[model samples]
Target chain A: MPDPVGAVARLQQELTRLPGVGPKSAERIAHFLLSGDRKTAVALADALRDVVARVRPCRECFNLTEGELCPICSDSRRDAGSICVVETPRDIALFERAGSFRGLYHVLGGRLAPLDGVGPDQLTLAALAQRVRRGGVREVILATSPTLEGDGTALYASNLLDGTGVTITKLARGLPSGSSLELANPQMLVDAMDGRRTL
Target chain B: MPDPVGAVARLQQELTRLPGVGPKSAERIAHFLLSGDRKTAVALADALRDVVARVRPCRECFNLTEGELCPICSDSRRDAGSICVVETPRDIALFERAGSFRGLYHVLGGRLAPLDGVGPDQLTLAALAQRVRRGGVREVILATSPTLEGDGTALYASNLLDGTGVTITKLARGLPSGSSLELANPQMLVDAMDGRRTL
Candidate 1:
C-alpha cells in the first residue's frame, strides 16, 4: 500500500527467507538495523557474502568447510573408518557439540523422500558408498532424523554399503520420537550416537 | 583450538550480533545459509546494503525513509497538526499497524536513561521542540515507552513544550505496566493512543 515505509519492507522481505525468521521477527530486525549504525548491517551483509563465497562442501564428507575437507574429515586423529551419515551440515555441528563422535561425517544434504521426489541420487549416497567401498571404513552410522524419511534414507544407505564388510548402524532411539538430529539435545545425541544399534 | 572448523565459526560469530540470535541460533542459521544456493546469501547481503545505502531518517519527523521524508510524513492524507512522539521507528510501525493515529511521528531515537548517562540532549528532544515551535502544531503526543526512562523522557518533553499552547498528551496506560511501546499489542496500543490523556 504506501510503498511499505522505507527500506524496512525490502529488508523484511530479505530477512524472512532465513531458516527461522518470521514476518514479525523480520520487521523487528529491519527496524533495529535501520535505526542503528550502518556498520552492523554492513557486517551482516559481509558475513553472508563471505560465507557464501568461502564455505564449500567438504570434499570427503559433505559438511561445510573453508577448505577442501571439513575439519573432522581432515583430522587424522579422528576415526575416518567410522563415518556418521547425517541429513544436513547442522547435524554435524550438533554431533560435534555432543562431543561423543570422534569420527568424520557424510552430509546427505537431505533425507530420501521418495514421495517428495528425493531419491538416492539426490543425496550424497554415491559419495558415502564410494567412501565405504574404497576400503578401511569399519562402520557407517546413519545419524539421520528419526522420521520416516530418515528411516528410508538409512535403509537405502545400508543397502548401498552392503557387502563392503562395513558394519552399518543407526543412532539409537534415545532421541525423542519425531525429532531431527539437529533438534536432539546434546546429551541425548551423545547417548544415541555412542550407543548406536547395528542396522 | 585447531582453528575451529571452517567458515562456519566465522559466520556464527557474525550472526550472534543480531538482536535475539544466540550462539546456538547463529550456528544453525550459518549452516543453513552455507548449504543453500548462493543467490540467497547474495540477496540477504544486498538487501542489507541497499537498506544501509538508501534508508535515511525523515527530516521532518526523524522516522525512517528511503527518501527525504518517510511515507507517513510524506502522505497528504495524514493529519499534520498532530505529532506522535516515539522511541523508535518500530513503534511507528506498530501504531500504523493498529490502523489508528493517522498523524505524523517524531522518533526520539531513545528515552532519557540517566543511569546510562543518556539525557535530553542525547535524544531528538531539541529537534522535537524546534519542530513544535515552528508552529501549526495543535497537539504533541508523547508516545515514549512506559519504563522509567520513558517516563522521564515524557516528563522532560512536557516541560519543554510548556506555554507553547500545543496540547501535550501521553498514551493511556492500556499497555501492560513496565513494558515498552514495541511490546504492546496493536489493539491495546490503539486503545492507549486513542484514549491518551493530556498531561
Candidate 2:
C-alpha cells in the first residue's frame, strides 16, 4: 500500500518509462533489484549514466556511436557504395544479426508518421541526402518494415532520390520464409504472387 | 557489430542481469534508451541510486522500507497480534493488492531450499521466532506458496512456534477460483479433493 518505500516507488516509476515496461513489470524489476545485493543496481545505474554520457549519433550514418563515426562507417571492409536504410538503429542490429548485409547503414531515426506530426524534417533524411550527394553511393536499399507507414516512407525517400542518378530499391514483400501459404494473410499472398520469380 | 559504442554494450550487458531480460531484450532496451532524450536514462539512474542508498529491510518484519519500521508495521489500525508470514516483501505487496489481509507481515526472505545451499540460518526465521516470543501475537499464518519448498518452510516455521502457545495455521490449498476442472492438474485435483470443506 502506497509503496513501502518512497525510493522504491520512484525507481518503479522511472522504470515504467522504458519501452515495453508496464507498471506491473516496473514494480517487479524494482523489487528484484532490491531483493538482490546492491551490486546489480549500482552497476545498472552506472551503465545507464555511461551510455547517456558517451553514446552519440555517428557523423556519417546517424547510427549510435561513442566517436565521430559508427563502427560500420569507420570500417574499410564494408561496402561504402551500398547503403541499407532503416527506420531506427535497432533495425541495424537486426540486419547485423542476420549477417547477410555487408554494406553500411543509414538510420532514418523514424519513418514518416504525418498523423502523429512526424515529417521528413524530423528525421535524419537531409543528412542521408547529403551523404548520398557527397559521393559514390551506387545503391540505396529501403529496408523499412512492410507496414503502410514504412511503404509511405520508402516511397517518399525514393522520390527524394529520383534525380540523383543512384539506383534506389526497397526490400521485397512476400510470405515470410518459414511461414505456410495457408497461414499467409491476403496482402502477403498478393505480394508473394506479384513478386514471384523464375527458379 | 561489437556494439557501436562500448558504453551502450556495457549498458546492455548490465540490463540482461535484470529479471526476465535476455540478451535480445537487453539490446532493445539499451538502444531504446540511446534513441530517446537523455532525460529518461538520467532519471532512471538517479532513481536506482536513490533506492539503493535509502531503502532498507524493515526492522520488525524484514519487509522493504526506508525507515526503521515498514508502513504496515507502523500503521496503528493493523492487527499486530496476527502476523501473515510470507517468503518475500514482494508477497506483501501482493497481499496488500488483494486488500483482504489486515494483519502485519513477517518476511521469511526465502523458502527452504537446502539443495541450493539455503539453510534455516540464511533466512530470518530466528528473527521471526524472537518476534513471536517477545509478544502478545495470537496467530501466525503461514502464507508461503503451496509448493514442496514452501510446505517445508511452513512446517519448519510451525514447529519453531510449537511451544509459544500461539495458533499456527497455513493457507488452504484447492482449485483456484474460476478455474475449470478439465484444466486442473492432477496435483491440484488431489489438493482440491483432500481439502474439501463442509458447506
Give the top-scoring candidate (lDDT): 2
C-alpha lDDT of all candidate models, in order? 0.83, 0.91
Considering the two chains of model 1, state its CAPRI-style docking category: medium
lDDT of 2 by residue, A60-122 (tens): 998888899899899999999999999998898889988999999999999999999989998
Q: On a 0 to 1 DockQ scale, where is model 2?
A: 0.78
**Chain B, candidate 2: TM?**
0.97
**lDDT per residue, candidate 1, A76-162, as tens digits?**
999877888999988877777768888888899999888888878889899888888898889889999977788888998898887
Off by over 4 Å in 1: A1-3, A175-199, B1-6, B175-199
Off by over 4 Å in 2: B2-4
* Model 2 chain B poorest 10 in a row by lDDT: B1-10
lDDT of candidate 2 over B1-199, digit per residue (tens):
6454688889988998888788888987888788757788999999999999999999999999999999999999999899999999999999999999899999999999999988999999999999999988999999998899999999999999989999999998889899899999999999999999999
Q: Candidate 2: deviation at residue B55, Å? A: 0.8
DockQ of each: 0.55, 0.78
